[model samples]
Target chain A: MSYRTIDRGAAATPEPVARKIRGLSDRAIAWIFVAPTIFLLLAINIFPLIWTIRLSFTNYKANRINREPEWIGLRNYERILTDSDIWLNMQATAHFLIWTIFFQVLIGFALAWLINKKFKGNDLWTTIIVLPMMLSPAVVGNFWKFLYQPQIGLFNYIIAFFTGKEPSSFEMLGQVNLAPWSIVIVDTWMWTPFVMLICLAGLRSIPDYIYEAAEVDRASKLRQFFTITVPMVLPFLMLAVLFRGIENFKMFDLVVQLTGGGPGSTTELTSINLKREAFEKWRTGYASAYAIILFVTVFGLASIYVKALNKVKER
Target chain B: MAYSKLATASAIAIAATGVAHSAQAEDLTLCWAAWDPANALVELSKEFEAQSGHTMNFEFVPWPNFADRMLNELNSGGQLCDLLIGDSQWIGGGAENGHYVKLNDFFDNEGISMDDFAPATVYAYSTWPKGTPNYYALPAMGDANGWFYRKDWFAREDIQAAYKEATGEDLREPQSQKELLQIAQFFQGREIDGKTVYGAAIFTERGSEGITMGVTSALYPWGFKYENEPGSYDMEGAVNSPEAVEALEFYKTFYETATPPGYTNSYMGESLDAFKSGQVAMAMNWFAFFPGLYADPATGGDKIDFFVNPPQNIAASTLGGQGISVVSYSDKQDAALEYIKWFAQPDVQAKWWALGGYSAHNSVLQDPGFVDSQPFAGDFLEAMDGVQDFWQEPAYAELLLAMQKRVHDFVVADQGTAQEALDKLIEDWNEVFEDEGKL
Candidate 1:
């Protein structure tokens, strides 16, 4: 049919379908709405990462404000890999992350389970338990250092009272043997409550009907818990693990306040080492490489953890 | 003709506005640490502004992160600061990176004399490579590391009698390493003023540069060398020689037996706390802190006295201080240089020292009344006279970190034997030098 004949089919021009079947233009308008968000994401996140990657291959001292920078091509990465101090800091960080996660999760989950039971003043107890995680890490680190004092501290007093011996003890921040564990204790004391809160939320979500069904089946309380409660709380526990893992991997502020990565490099975590290299040592190119390595490592671990979390959710 | 006249008048008005703007922009900014010294400098700088007719901008950073903050601002080539009072440790890196203007020609052109300032202070902090190029920085604060003790405790007849009975000699302030050890031993765990007090406490903090300051005073007098016979930067045996090892062992013994039980974590603040609390009979610290020590009524009431760090093989302490520098990136260089010159005058420097500051001017420090003005003035002057600095190489930061690591391991951690600590320190120092092509 001719184009004119299609238009002449009805009286008054059949009102020319004012609402066109607009498809591509509507999608184009939708993209226009999201363009700012895409630009923002690329500007804030992607740009810095690309810049850091570029700096990693150069010999740019971030502190050297005026010197013309030259490209060195992976020399900084080579140097970081070979540097014993960098490796030592990585080891310290690994030790801290693994141990702190273990203790925080174990203790937090236990506390959550205990508090989940119906008891008098359970709400008050839970509030009191989670209060430490609310305090600033700097405040916790400073006060804990004072509490860890060998002679004059209350911790020593407690030990002396129970053992009835003279209160001479190891220096917490000074001696290397005790310093790393000192950090561990402080970190656990602060963050274990966070894990506990997550576990509690998970525990509270368990329906009573599931327990009732298990009871009808004449199952033991332990058997019911193993079958119903644990599987239900598994996703929450993984979430708690993911958070604490990411947090402890970048631990800097508390260590800075408590020991300042000291009694001499004994507790210098990777972040602290990176900061020293970047700021104090003025080795910006090298520190950028160090940061990239840490970032990649954390990113890889988090991706794996997210996959595990997906599996838990599916189950 | 009427239109031409109007255009000329308008052009003349705009040119006048530009001239006025130029005059108003003649202002300078000064940055320094936030403390008594900075307050005194601010007071003195106002006089310069009054006389020179230039505005002043002062930025006083807290002592902890002052270096990092200033370096960031300087490197960005921003005019956030024009002049700075910087720690001596920052001179090498700051100068080499062109963050500061070389002041030799400026000093010459203005008839400004560096001789009026303390030679040691200028030699330690102002020159790059320890007196090579006049690259950047000027002498501002002339603080030096020194030892302080309770003169009353040292003068006690009972302590003297007890020490004489035990060692078969009269107890006097030690002048050599062996004697210093003996003196420290004599007062270990002594009951004084009806309270049990320790003999001495020198800071051994693993953080920052506290331990390095303590170890340097002991190392300087043991015939140690910071440079080789050919006059290159050599800190090998100097840091961990047999004599240095012996000195460290003695220090460890003093720490274990003579120091307060909680001294390993001691920093400047803790040392002050211990001294103020009367728990320590002796301490080694910065001379600038003498004002703070004397200002406190608890310890300032004629209870605390001081002496220079006792001589070992040579009488020296770490050349500790800061330098005033003009930012090369700043447009207000002329104004800043004028303010610095005004600050260096003897009369102004005397006021600076009198109003709770350490004078960097030689004339001001040497004035007869300087000793009588402040309680620790005599000791301060004596300590400043005996100042020696660390290697002022461009790689000084790396060198300091390397030294701190080894010294901390030996003294605080006891992770390795003294010999092993020294051997590793040598290797590390050589590694740094090799990387810089200094070896």
Candidate 2:
């Protein structure tokens, strides 16, 4: 089957072009094919990063082009590390990231397990469950804002109907104590399906013969689930957690549309704070340092987490 | 017969030349905030188009992200706008960064004097170093923060009796800041026509300039100042004065005790919606939206009325307006200048005010019927007379954001004492000024 295809490819390439290609060594040919990608990676990914690192040591303001930037050494980093507001933003980010992952992983695995079982209208339920994730985060944020409104929101109405309280008794997005959890609930609602799909893939990858062999061994249902199902899906669950964690770390648009990092900085995650510094405040050099610190933190965490995932896979 | 054919050819040549002259007209894009007044500007510009052969295009952005979008365009040296109706706070940056063309010569050549416009507008919207007239723009719109209320409810007998019984005073327009708060509290949770209505919808939004502008209405009246002395960045007692603390605490009390439940992150649009939908008894917004509000069939006419923001310690209001500047990067400088020169005329400004765009020209403001022109006209003039503005420094954004965070923290989040909030604000401002080498 391959001889005809190979002959047709040789005939399709012009004779002079094929000869030129055939003259080059394999390594050079490979480089010829990949040079554009390398150039693109350098131009987009590497060069800007290097430039940002340089700017981190200077006092360059993006809006003040008339003024010359001065070299300020590590002063920008020093100031960032010492700023209490920045630390508070970091804590807010941590709170969001950890809770969102915890909730997403918990509900996602449960949904995947239940959907894995044979049931009527399973595909329909699965599609319904995945609907929230299909919408834009901005759209989700805007609609959820209406839902969280106290006077007219459907969410407050649902709460009031259950608790026999007034619909205007509480504000989900307005109060300090509830605003953080409000974002958490929305994030969990939108992204749990993403984790569920991954978990579903994990659950489906387990062969039927394994369960049959466990049945032959007289293994109880509880023992087989604890031993086989949980352990096998552990790697997939960890992968989902890693993906959601990185994403929630950079959560900006949804939170912006919801609270705008407020009820006074209670929901001011680091990304939103960084945007204020960079764009709103135009503290370019300081923001550059902030960005580098965030980049390193994410890169380091992902590297360590990836290593752990690989180890789990090996096990 | 040959002579007649030649004469016909000459007539065709003349007609083609006229068409070519018409085709030479430049299309000028004027950028501004997307609001009711932007529509007025569009309608008014039709006159400019007929007068000058240049077509007008507008790129209107919503208020929340207007600064972010337009600043990015300017920072990138984009040619998207030939003229920009930028906020007054941007005059410093616009002049310093060369984003706006210096208009001193243009004004002189066109026989336009700075004295022809309102002094406050010229100082806020046209100058760079506070009062020095390094003109970068022409004052296009004049506005200030003011209040509007439900006039029909105030006249209700039962409501008036209830308010009098509750506060031992007749329900009328508030004369002081405390009276305003008292009135708002009286309206809070009051049942009207079998529907629960709240006090007011004031700005508490955190992302942009909403809360800062709203709070400044109180701050300015309480005699808040950016500096202890003019041209000095000394903000020690001036920013954290007892008066300012009182004003800030007053605003917080208003927010806490009066505003509708779940009205936390509201700005201008939300405030307008609250008043229009009969959810609030009083609401605060810029005077620019008054024309549209008065035109609202349900809420306007006899149902609503305007008031200048009541004074606390002194007479003051927050300024809300912009100057129209020719973008330096635009290639259509001549056409853009022509638009400005045409706009600065007394007749055109009169037309602008008639079409609902606020005109800062003295000729319009000093008209015999100016005060009696509309119901809000007197209040607008009063508000503009005592209007105060935030810092117009190039780093005004940073300063405004600092105040936004500190004030929002104390007022909306109930986090800190009023004194502490102002003290922390002083610290933030000091840091910014230090960064700018102005400390």
Candidate 3:
């Protein structure tokens, strides 16, 4: 009778057991497929992340490797959090983010909409407009620096032509107020096309039948655009925002080449400050802590943004 | 047939031994910044290799990432470089961190005393924080900061005559900050060399070392000190003194009126470019660039001239240069030390001067033969005499960054009054000192 009860229970639960056995094999296969990828991810990303976190708790100067690292828990974090300069750098980064996002989205959406309309040489115009995105940021920053030159630059020359007086003799990168905005302008020029490309894909993916049906319903072009075009492209727009946000958040090379966080700390982003702390100052522990803080901040923002993007997509 | 096979095997063994000997031949690797001085050092190294029977491998890195690259190499415990040429400011950290092999015994054995070098050059960049801290590096490039001008323009009889007529005083070399500013004002917006030239050019960029070096050269002589108090490592009152504020105000005036309007972003490279292009009548520069400016025809090689940094209440110039040191991690420490000994020989130093190396040996620099050989030797030695070495501390890089930021804010941002900027710098510098437990 006990044996019979056991058999009955086994039969009833066989679905989950069989499913679990099948799931185990499936998991094995899945792991087998992803083993190389996992190895790569660990090698390229997770290992470094763990090492950086470990270094954040120890005093590790790059120049002094042989010396035993001392555990200085929470000191680096304390320094960064309490430091006014770090906070100022954070403000600078925030300023860059707000201005860059506003300009990139507004300008990008408009360009995408205009290009979606079948105009003459639409393909050629679109290609030319998108070219800046393909160019390296360093290359673009360098050329724009040349353009802002007061004496021999084309930008000044054109300004001089319009005004009867010689162009306003302001040094764009030299002025503290202007330097941050200069970076914003250049970033916008280079990346608006990227946003536009995504929006364009979204626009093209919207079925033409929707527009046809709206026209049959006697909806005005403005009404149709608001009801269909915007709604359809919103998800793609969020995706573009997510990408550009992450990228611009970690900007280093271009700023280093262009203004070098200069004209004062006006253009010194958080990443640049962190670099100065770590490599230049050789305060490894402090820099690592700064990195962790930045990672957490960016990760949190990105997570929230990604969820929003998913919601938009679902709708 | 067995005897024949044995003979063949012996012959093959002998050939393999020969190959092994070849593989063991002496090879030395050297690394440095890929700047003009580094180029000169490379040229000198070829001569050394030819004479010493050692094959040399050269590694030249760009200036921007140079420190990080050298640090990585040193910390890796890899035999990347046998002989490393590095900035003098790195000496303290290098010594404290055991990145460089101590050279006191080596110097003594070689009979190459530090006293032979310009006293100012030897101490500023080559010495560690503690006076007796192992003496890790040999003073190699005893470079200093100084002023460069166009001799042709300065000696212009018509301009001098006009200035003399107006002021009833002979227009001559600048001897003080007051005179330098006056000279700048005299030449502001003047047409020269077929273009409108500015009076002066100096670096003012943020986060760069150039601005701090240039600005502090003026400020220090005017009673500004980066240390908090004499004989104290505390860095509070020194940076934001009344004298420093006055000096900065004077600097601002020159930048606003006499300098090229775009002076705020200028660095060594840009300042040199401006001078070479004849956009500026004078510039403050690293003395290392003197040879290159003299060699390059684009800058009127024969016409360019220089002066020791002028005094305000006292004479001063920013100390800048490189030191030659053996890698502490080297497997061939003895061989590296041997190289430094040979490098310090009087005859070798003379050759170094001939090949454009800034000889730290006073005997070579002050040699009548050397002076006669190079027309600019006198000025170079004069500038060397005036140089004050960088502030030596284990946390020097951080100290410099703090100063650079504040100096940038003062000159470029105009974010606060000069006093306010200097006060902030003092506070920041003190914070660093406090963190390091020196204050």
Candidate 4:
């Protein structure tokens, strides 16, 4: 049959079908297409989040399937809040987060500033500088472990070379005093490149005319840098800080690979402690509560940080 | 008529295929820690495969991640592992959580007697309530902490004379913990073969159970006990007795004075490396690794010798090894059980030993020439006789982690006194038991 004949015959038939087809709006059709994605998000992300929050209120163990979870009201949260070890973990995490970000921002901005100056083999130097961040954090953690070894590690030997101390005189990851700094050093080494790249972008985005205008106005090199360069780059620097802050707050794999959170809980971040509770100890409810606390802390801090960044940008 | 004939032929063909499939070999996945014995088990499992008409698939995770991976699989009800040779401490958790198939009825029906296994292995690996008849697993590998030393270094005439002159005693195998410490101290920074060598590399690993495993050898010999009574969570005095404090102090002293530089987190692998590299004169490690150590061309061949962990007030060694269990979540329990049955035979166990896997079977361990079979065989038997284990409660991980942190802080970090560390450990363990409603 001809296509026209088939279409005419179909049109002549079923008034109910034609009305049904015409009744659906463009917005309704769009909802039909987007429904699956929304359902998936609810299933995988939202559902688990709600379930975890619910579980935080109970005495539940994921491993003990034989026992039904008992609702213990705010017991888990109360215990966590009162727990000294959790506070110690928080202290360790804070030490790590503060020191790592400080070093990364300082060294990263310096490197970016230097590289932004047109220099010989600048592209090659940039690639080399970015290499550590490009590698797997697990791989970097493992190799850095070897490098931190006191007996044969190149790191100790290099330090010894300059300081006139014995190569095996100090233990990096072994001593309580050195372990936290050791993790900080490694994190700075690996992630500083990321901050450098962001700063480099920020540096490059400043229009040449701004610097030229400053030069014509007889502004000193340092004054121009502070007034024009840094102020303009503040938003991007804040963005870098925000990203690193969130990432380091939940840091697990690298620290785990490097030290497994310890010569003693000295380097145990909150994430590492939570993992020990949730998976190793099988304390599901306690871990969930701990996770929620961490979530709230991160969320509250980031919100404040973003608002501050927005204010700075408005200036 | 033709359609009917075709249908009949197809039905017969389908039945024939089903029968063929049933007769074909089944594939069984056995999960274990990736260690020397695991490799040995892989070689030994071939015999089972050939005899039982089943193909063996192995999932071997490294020691650090093994418990995490396997427990996750069990908790998630994943059927990834049909048979799991899990750590001894997992018996309580597995049994209570129904992760492992209860093997009592199966053992009775299959005529597989638990009595055939070594008593300590059965106690550590199979039972949950210490001495109960409840069976969840079959003891597969037997291990206990033992010492390996450089026999050649001790045999040197100059070193022997110097050691005797300095200590006023003959240089020999340590008969007591005091002597062990002296030997370790004597060898520390001692020049051997024109190279400076350090002392014994004991387990100081901070992460998992390394320090606890190492320190307990000293603890048990120095009169440390977990409780005043079995099944009681009462750890107040027993875990922190005066002798236990002394033991902890001694362990810390040894770690500081004897071990090589940066030996902060050394476990079996690190100890082996230190020994093989000639960086240390002696080391403490599990019996399971002894065979591999003895076979190493660089460090073996009259240069190395094995000894039991020395006595103090009492002689004891830390128990190490695992039991094999069928995962309850697995669909192929029958096949897995058949594999176990084949593995349980005396000959197979003997072959397992010959392939370097520690066979916990009494028949294998009790062989007339078993002690004479390998260089470390006698030491293994002696150590196994005095083996002590950590708590086997369902909350063992919590207890272990607390001990790890406490002991590590005191021993490695030098953060607190031994008494304080043990007291803190007691508090932590009591808290865990309270949470479990056992206190």
Top candidate (TM-score)? 2
lDDT of 1: 0.79
Query: What is the lDDT of every predicted structure here?
Result: 0.79, 0.94, 0.80, 0.92
Q: What range of 10 consecutive residues in model 1 chain A has the weakest lDDT sum?
A: A14-23
What range of 10 consecutive residues in model 3 chain B has the weakest lDDT sum?
Answer: B125-134
lDDT of 2 by residue, A78-138 (tens): 9999998889899989999999999999999999999999999999999999999999999
Of candidate 4 chain A, the 10-residue stretch with the lowest lDDT total is A13-22
Q: Residue A240 deviation, candidate 4, in Å?
A: 0.8
Model 1: residues >4 Å from true position, as ranges? A1-27, A65-74, B1-28, B49-57, B133-135, B229-231, B234-240, B368-375, B434-439
DockQ of 1: 0.42
Q: lDDT value for candidate 2?
A: 0.94
Tens-digit lDDT string for candidate 2 (B1-439)? 9999999999999888778658768999999999999999999999989877789999999999999999989988999999999999999989989999999999989999999999999998999877897999999999999999999999999999999899999999999989999999999999999999999999999999999998998899889897899888888899999999999999999999999999888899999999999999999999999999999999999999999999978999999999999999999999999999999999999999999988999999999999898899999889989999998889888999998999888988889899999999999999998888887
Q: Write the per-residue lDDT of candidate 1 for residues B18-42, one digit (tens) a residue.
A: 7765675477888887776777767
Give chain B TM-scores in order.
0.87, 0.96, 0.88, 0.95
lDDT of 1 by residue, A40-113 (tens): 99999999899989998877766555556788898888888888877888889989999999999899989999
Tens digits of per-residue lDDT for model 4 on B53-115?
Answer: 689999999877787898889889999999999999989989998899999999999999999
Question: Please, what are the lDDT tens digits per residue for candidate 3 over residues B348-439?
Answer: 78777777778888788767776667656776677767666555666778878888898787777777889887878778777777666676
Per-residue lDDT, model 4, residue B90, is: 88
Ranking by lDDT: 2, 4, 3, 1
- Pairwise DockQ winner, candidates 3 and 4: 4
Q: Residue B83, candidate 3: how far off, in angstroms?
A: 1.0
